[model samples]
Target: MPHPTGPRVRLRAGTRLRTTLALVLLAATLTVGAVGVVGVVATTSTAAEAPRTWVVDAVDDTSGNRWDSVDTGTSVVTIRVGDTVEWQFDRATQGHDLVSLAPSQPWETVWPTALQEYRDAGGPSVTYTFDQPGTYRYECSLHGPLMTGTIVVVPADSTNQPPTADPVVEPLTGPAPLVVHATANASDPDGDEVVVAWELGTGGAPTYTDHTMVEYTTPGTYVVRLRVSDSRGGLHVEEFPVTVTGTGGPGTDPPTDGALPAIDALAAPAQGTAPLAVAFSTQVTTRGEVHPYSVGLDDYPSIAGEAVLVRSRGRTHTTLSVTGTKPSARHGSVHVHEQACDDELGGAHFRLDTTQPFAEPNEIWPLFTSDASGASGLVEVTKAVRAGPQAVSVVVHDPDNAARRIGCADLAPGTADLTYSWAFGDGTTATGADPDHTYATPGTYTATVTVAHASGEHAGHATVSDAVTVVVGAAATSTPSPTPVPVVDGTPPRISRVGPVRTVRTSRPVVTARVRDAASVVSKKAIVIRVDGRRATKVRWDRARGIVRWRPAKALAPGRHVVRLVATDAAGNRAARRWRFVVRLR
Candidate 1:
């Protein structure tokens, strides 16, 4: 369903990187194609050392002091030629892709040389062999810097193997003041001794040790790093993420305590009204602390505004009254999600079908723009009364990059009494109990309304909708498309001549052809005659009957000679004829 004239939200994931899949298939060794199942640990080929397989898991948590979107564990992996590197996709909660990058090149130089990879959870295992020995850089095509790493491939030999590092932490998540014991099980494949050092990742100097205990005093997130260095100057780093919860202190809820100061239902349509009109209104504030997973710290400036959502029936006839999210007039995506502000990307878009296709008609999208002040906004939507929990929070996306979420607001429940949606029939729509629209063209249209009670007598109840016939009496006109030009078939003059096979008694031979066209008249200037592959100097022509005669410039000394005639008409069409005569010396 498309609305040619209706207001629609631009739901852009902002990751247009999927289009580069073609480039990935062309230059990549293993990418998306012929889907199948492979072992969790598989080798491309076997030779001397059985080609050990390195498992690089998908790390998608923001427990680290710094948020790196979806990363392939181990910032750097050292491998030998012919060995396999397997990228696991089971842990990627959100869509993540692996793409090769040109490390020396700048950001603008992406795609043509970038490796393209697409693998969803439970799809398949992605792996590639390093047939060539060198350093190769790769990163997530969508997340870029936030999810990047390096791969070092050397000649396969009894080289000093880099120590493999994996951190074992007691608890990954728990309450505040939690004491955590961590150990790095590291060993070199070449049986070489390695040294280990631990850094709290939050800040401070590295502590030299094999295992240590750290005390967590606040509720937040932390990451501990363990770098194991081999005596051969080869080192690899591994990170361990930990979550620290507070006892309802400042560390737990720093930004407004995840609450909206004011919430109101601006509409109240009576029960039994099929098409109900309602608007859920509330105040939203953008706090950097609210959304931590954002790529940048200051993606959204601090601002506040009242957000209102108006909804009608089946198709969301949505109207967002809350505007002025920023200092200037610009648009961004605002979607109603099912979870709280705690989940990544607000869990997911609150959808009704919860299946294959997901977009506009399937989900509720509220749009907002900065009126003048550079701050907050909200969206309006239409759903059943039971949609209260599903429509918990509103997520605002960056105006320039829709994938980077800038702000999130948890909507207080039971705020709106009735919601409304209206279809003006001319492919246009309106939301809110009282909506006004102006039609430009004169035509009969079927206007419709869908309404639902949000709270009170019908909390989490069903919805009703009604339609009515509408007619506009004004006159309108339209111009038809222009016709194409026709071709002049068989209009060019034809060169016709009749000749008998004869041995020329004389050295010079003459040839002639006539030019005639029933559709058009032919002119003498349009006729050309040639003798022996050269233009005939002594030529005879008849204008009235359209005839031409041509002879060689000199006496014919060859065994055979050819004479040609061509005639052309005003329609840019031409015709030609050729004849040959034999010249013999007596």
Candidate 2:
């Protein structure tokens, strides 16, 4: 047996024991020879045993410290007694020595200095076999505390054969609320029935099974264990490491003196008109700390709306109503944006106009308080800031650290009250949300409507209807009035010129088409071109010249290619043309 914390003595053959064994064997052989002419037979049997080997390497690299295990690349190793551990030095410019130290002992006093071995490039490897069950701490004397390692030794069983356990865990690292599937492949050499058990590091009753699933609610490193045992008292244990990471949830750091609460959710409107009255709702979770906080349209003394401070708990829910008067003068429109900073207290300001000073009094929206649980609020602006498609967003910030931004939301425009203006192609016009007009004499006419919103304007055409037509006498008389001429659109858009219509070897040859419509092209988006049945890449339309240009993103294969062009006009009329050309390899 070896001392619990001391190095074990190496096993070596002794001269005295060998001589005594040889003499006993010789005496037995002589006695058999003297007995008679009968032949004497000699047989020998010995039990076979070998020590397990583990390796560590020392290298001078920033990837890892000087001393790292060659097998696992970590500083820790677990082994049974009678297992050999070897340390090899591979750095040519640095010399390192492995020295054992007592618990809480100074590094200058390495116990049993005779056992320490220094090595460098081409140096001999040092080997040691542990014979005691205890944690052994060692370090490189040259590198001081920078290089350190630990070895955990277990006592070897001499009675029944111990079982072997192979443990596996999937997705060892992830965010909180992590689910890990743990399984073990265990076997007993003595053919004895083995029992497997699992224990989670979070402190719960151990589970008896070969396979089990465990979930971690908090963020931290958890040690999961698998144990196997035989009826004859042989046992084996293996460890699985799991790491969970996140800002909040269970298993996170316990509440400290100044730790901030977490915000769970926030809700509010994105856009509203003047005299906006907003109901802001919020939910937060605290870390067992007393956090008397306020909710309002902005942070602290500069708040433009309302701020109500209330005591919060592990889970808190509150709603605050914030109202603001709309600016009388509209310089330009300003967006209500939310900037989230969970780590710090500073965020960007809402600027409605460059000439106006940046202050919460001018802007009505709130900057959310930072919290890991997440915080929410609502704000109502009584007046419109600016018009014409203003961009709005909600910015989220960390409660504890206001400078850190954690999340955001881009708000969509609110519904608008619209006014419609209509033009009947029969030379008649009307204005109203919904207008009623009668045609006196009409054969065919195109009706169009233009709608105006608070921010912008849009126009669309109405479907043709039979109610608009009037028949004034079916037959012509001797003194009949002049007949009305019906408006007609019979001309289609014409393609003035097209290129690459013959042949080309370059795969990326440019294809151009000059198109024009008598009425007018609806938009550049109305033009489309395809090559070989596939849409061409980078299709651009030059509105000034009515030219559409496109090229293949990839080189065209060597073959005949078909190009198609489609164009549409404001009258809802469309024109299409197709042509073919050959592509040759260069």
> Which candidate's TM-score is highest?
1
**Runs of candidate 1 exceeding 4 Å displacement:** 1-79, 82-94, 97-154, 161-168, 183-193, 203-206, 211-213, 217-223, 233-239, 247-378, 381-586
Q: What is the total number of backbone clashes in candidate 1? A: 25
Model 2 lDDT tens row, 527-547: 778887887756878664356
State the weakest 10-residue window (summed lDDT) of model 2. Answer: 16-25
Model 1 residue 239 CA deviation (Å) reads 4.9
Candidate 2 positional error at 199, Å:
3.5
lDDT of 1 by residue, 255-341 (tens): 232222221122221111223232222111111112323542364443222232323222222323332234665544567665555
- lDDT top scorer: 1
Please give the distance, in angstroms, between residue 85's alpha carbon in candidate 2 and its true position after superposition: 4.6
Q: What is the lDDT of residue 302 in candidate 1?
A: 38
Give TM-scores for every candidate, taking all chains together and pairing residue i with residue i. Answer: 0.33, 0.26
lDDT of 1 at 122: 51
lDDT of 2 at 250: 20
